[model samples]
Target: MEIFTTVWKDWTMYQKSSLLLMGICIFIILISCIYIITRNRRLIIHAIASILCSAIFTVGTMVILHVVFDERISYIYMLIPLVVFLVDIISLSMNLGYYTSTRNKKSFSPISVKKELLRDSLQLSIFIILLFSAISVFMGGALFTFVIAMGATALLIPWTNYLLLYWIYR
Candidate 1:
């Protein structure tokens, strides 16, 4: 633990943030895949949507605050996502237990108006994140690249959500 902590402390701001963000994504994808195993996706899909919102908001705020001020991002940015990842893992485990405990008793309710919006919003955010990630990978996380990626992510989230919501529901 000490060695790992020391190594983490030595990493640059970009490296630390990138590692945390990647961890966030990998955990989210894992949770989503686990969610897919259920016979009904109503709860999981909506849950994914809310999770995505929280993920983007925390990361976006961290990134934007850094970009706008040219300062270091607080660890609060990374910690929130880490906490979410931990929660998701626990939820996934419980979900699996619930699924197996009683085949006749399913907990997920039918999709409602709220669930529909959550699912749609999550889907859109994923698309936007992918588009940005592709661009970032191509450019590489060099100097200024992190800022660009974060800035773009922060700026595009609302636009994407609004556009998708209008296009899909309106």
Candidate 2:
């Protein structure tokens, strides 16, 4: 019980910049997911670029946290980003698989492709949200910071969708 308390206390002490970076990462993931669902080639490219940038930022933030704050790394702290990375990889793999599977099929419908993409997006979103919730539960650092993190995680979905649609149609 005491150990749990200590760990929670430590987790809550995240720096403001670290929290902001994490939020940006989540935003990137959400945008990628939205683009995947839409199947817009141009938008997908932009989202991928954003994802790469965010990944770089996230790694830099992690390094700063480790060196400057002297914080010990833990799997719990990395869970959400790892899951987001996995989801991106999985989505790419699925796209390749779909292309290969349909190579010989003459009657491939755009509707089917859209459906599958939507399904994948929904699954990724659910997993991301669950990961965020789990992380929040074990977070012991700063309560206000945690709340900001939670807000960012929660807002990512709708904000990404809205921005993607607005940009794509504009």
Q: Model-by-model lDDT, in order? A: 0.50, 0.52
How far is 47's C-alpha from truth in model 2 (Å)?
8.8
Model 1 pairs whose backbones collide? none
* C-alpha TM-score for every candidate: 0.36, 0.41
Task: State the lDDT of candidate 1 residue by residue for 107-142, as single tens digits.
Answer: 433223324434544655575566656666666434
| Candidate topping lDDT | 2
Model 2 quality (TM-score): 0.41
For candidate 1, give the lDDT of residue 32: 67
Residue 108's lDDT in candidate 2: 60
Task: Write down the RMSD of candidate 2 (Cα, Å).
Answer: 11.4
Per-residue C-alpha lDDT of model 2 across residues 1-170, encoded as one tens digit per residue: 33345556776566546866876777677666756565557546645654564355445544555566655545545544554445455554454355446645886655444455556656766766676666667666654233334334333433343343345435
